[model samples]
Target: MPRSRSWLPLLALLLLPLLSAIATAADDTRPNILFLFTDDQAPWALNASGYDQAHTPVLDSLVKEGVYLTNAFTVTPVCSPSRASLMTSQYGSELGITDWLHPQREPEAGLKPGTLTWAKVLQDAGYRTGLVGKWHLGLTDAMHPTKFGYDYFMGFRGGGNSPKNPTLEKNGETKKFEGLTPDILTNHALEFLNVDSDKPFCLSVHYRAPHAAWLPVADEDWAPFKDLDPMIPNPDYPKLNVDRVKKMTREYLASVASVDRNVGRILNLLKEKNLDDNTIVIFSSDHGYNMGHNGIWHKGNGHWVLTENPPFTKNIPKGQRPNMYDNSIRVPTMIRWPGVVQAGSTIDKTVSNLDWFPTLLEMAGAELPADAKIHGNSFVPLLKGDDAKWDNDFYAEYSTKHQSHTHMRMIRTSEWKLIRDFLNEGRDELYHLTEDPAEANNLIASNSPEVQSVIKQLDAKILANMQAINDPVLKEAKAKSSN
Candidate 1:
């Protein structure tokens, strides 16, 4: 009888191709990404964050189904810079985008061509990337989303848009739409999701709601808070007029309600399509906002005038001095990746928009360019419930030639925060959050040894961060001050 033919070699060759096919299928099963970004939203704006009056049922449910970050912040408090940091995963000072782009003045200031964004990385890795919302990073043809990494771009290019009868850009063509801007944007997002594609997708849906110019929302959304009297923050500053505060609160809450309802629409769509299990959904804001907190009506310049008469004066001198209060810099952030991130969990450690780039890239299993200079470490380990290696401190900076707010840097720990005005404006602030969570008391002028010690520690940290990022303001300001 002939020796038993060894089938091992033939079987090995046949199984190799089958194994390769299985690997390809596994790669194709990578999770889809849905990033939901909001404008000027604070951490406390949602009912999930303990705001009893906020009608944000959708967000509240999301909080229950995801990891809520109580200590999330933007690298800068302004719109363009904060959004830039999110896109680049670097500080605004490093990118030279320190203020909101003024079309006439800073027309040339934006993300330049060849800048590697997380979206570009994922796109290059075979994911179908789309951005359907505000693209405040830039407006020039070369700076458009298509030039960056987006296969589909449909939204406003500027910082904001009118809620009603707004005009939008569809891959560079301006189109007019009639309806609330959030709802309209959601419809466009759903349209993008419905596209015929077999590859994994990344969609960024940024909503321009609850930002500013708070107007009456749809009658249904406005009805819940119409007669409600929300509790407004009362810092040690002069007391605000109660009636005026209530009116602003009502309108703001109404706008938030509209945003929440629209968020529900997106969530429902994901469930209906059975994509909830493999889709990673993230919600956050560019930065925080203040309605009547700390005697401030809005963000940045924290000042408002209270009339002593029945009919309040409309022409209150707007305060031009910007502030670094938590209400302005700390934003609400959450992420939901089914079976990955623990449901109903909360992370108290400090995290910023700067970490988004590395985190997303890690989730996509893509490699960063060897020469890429990224300042943010991936927080994916924290999402997987490993906090032992997390950083508990955060640093931020804001610089502007805009006369209203100028060069400033801040360093914050869990219990203390120190802000220094690099221009020697003598408008510095320090707060011990453990004792004063409202930031009502400023300790910059304190002579207490404990306060001084904390300041010394934080000052060194701020300088280290500035040096690491090659902060131009710090370098220039030090030179000017020394000279």
Candidate 2:
């Protein structure tokens, strides 16, 4: 996770009891967390069924059993930085992890070998941790999960998975399978569970499905959907059915279906172990994709001002990319903590991937360090139906591919969203979700003063969020640069 958030003495001293009671040696308190994170999945694409054509049967069922947050977001919309944020509970700005698939292809990311990960905190406080699939943080062995508190480590270390070159490592031993992706990963996770029968563990089951280079699921599983959209698309952006695009989306769903089956398998294993009642299941994705939404193919790429070939993805200038719009940042958050959280409940409160850290900490009853600085706050209380006023806004930032001054930052609430960019005239984009739910109109600089007033409110929200997670280091650097 990148190093953003806040550092201060924990105000709630009473949380110690809660921590100890909930966390076992390796399984922290508040039910074992099974965080199922996928890549490039849109909230709208998840089991919308007739509304949208995506097969996520297992995820669909899981959402029905518990709470589904419609407005969940990621701090950064890309790969490495987003997961880093989840692991550390800090935004990339805080962690200094500004890019995905970091240029250095190490094992655990650039994170220090012995640095205490949020997982380490849980493991230290009494929880067994296991992470499976796509650890794209840094590539160094020192960044490996086993040393960082996870008892098990089996997955790859890149933005996308390669079935042919699938790298599965157990402890320090590694195996590269020239086979399928989900099969290899699911087997690795299953192998870990099969070996350790009794330890209460938190497994972060990451599926690189619905991502690029989409492939079909195992036979008999996705065979049902094979006919749904047999063709797949290439990596080209914005086209729904160009070349392999349709096939790719189909393959994406097939991959998702396979991942779902794995989820089912894992759940069955838990139930077999009588751990279902004591577990929490969360399903989400890092960011979203543009499947022909206004001719946008992928994310972070925008249409040019005049050359209208469609903007989701294009051969654009290196530094210029799309703004930090909600479509690319918003994701589905389906959580099930049976008996503790409401059944079939839908919470519209704005949440971010950063919240996962502190939420897990609070749930497990672990002690946060006095000097620990985290940007995210715990939403566990809200999940439990406690009427609390959580923040209405979540923040998102996106930097250009070339690391130029082309950057965008946004603050989004339920009914409104504001994107301010130094690149686009600090071009402020304002959206009134009440009318334009899809965020089509820019209310900023509109004719109506009332519409323009929302821009002011949004501007204020962005500044407040910035201050909430402001790092003195970065602020000093910015000030220095300006001077």
The TM-score values for the models, in the order shown, are 0.92, 0.82
TM-score of 1: 0.92
* Candidate number with greatest lDDT: 1
lDDT (Cα, tens digit) per residue for candidate 2, span 374-473: 7788899889999998887777776555423445678777788887764435356788877887665777777887877777777777766667777343
What lDDT would each prediction earn against the true structure?
0.84, 0.69
Weakest 10 consecutive residues, lDDT, candidate 2? 304-313
Query: In candidate 1, what are the lDDT values of residues 334-436, reduced to their tens digit?
Result: 8999999999999888899989999999998989988887778888898999846777799998875564556779998889999988865666799999999
Task: Return the TM-score for candidate 2, rounded to 2 decimals.
Answer: 0.82
Candidate 2 segments whose C-alpha is farther than 4 A from its true place: 1-30, 48-52, 104-109, 112-116, 197-199, 229-247, 301-321, 402-405, 424-428, 471-483
- The lowest-lDDT stretch of 10 consecutive residues in candidate 1 is 308-317
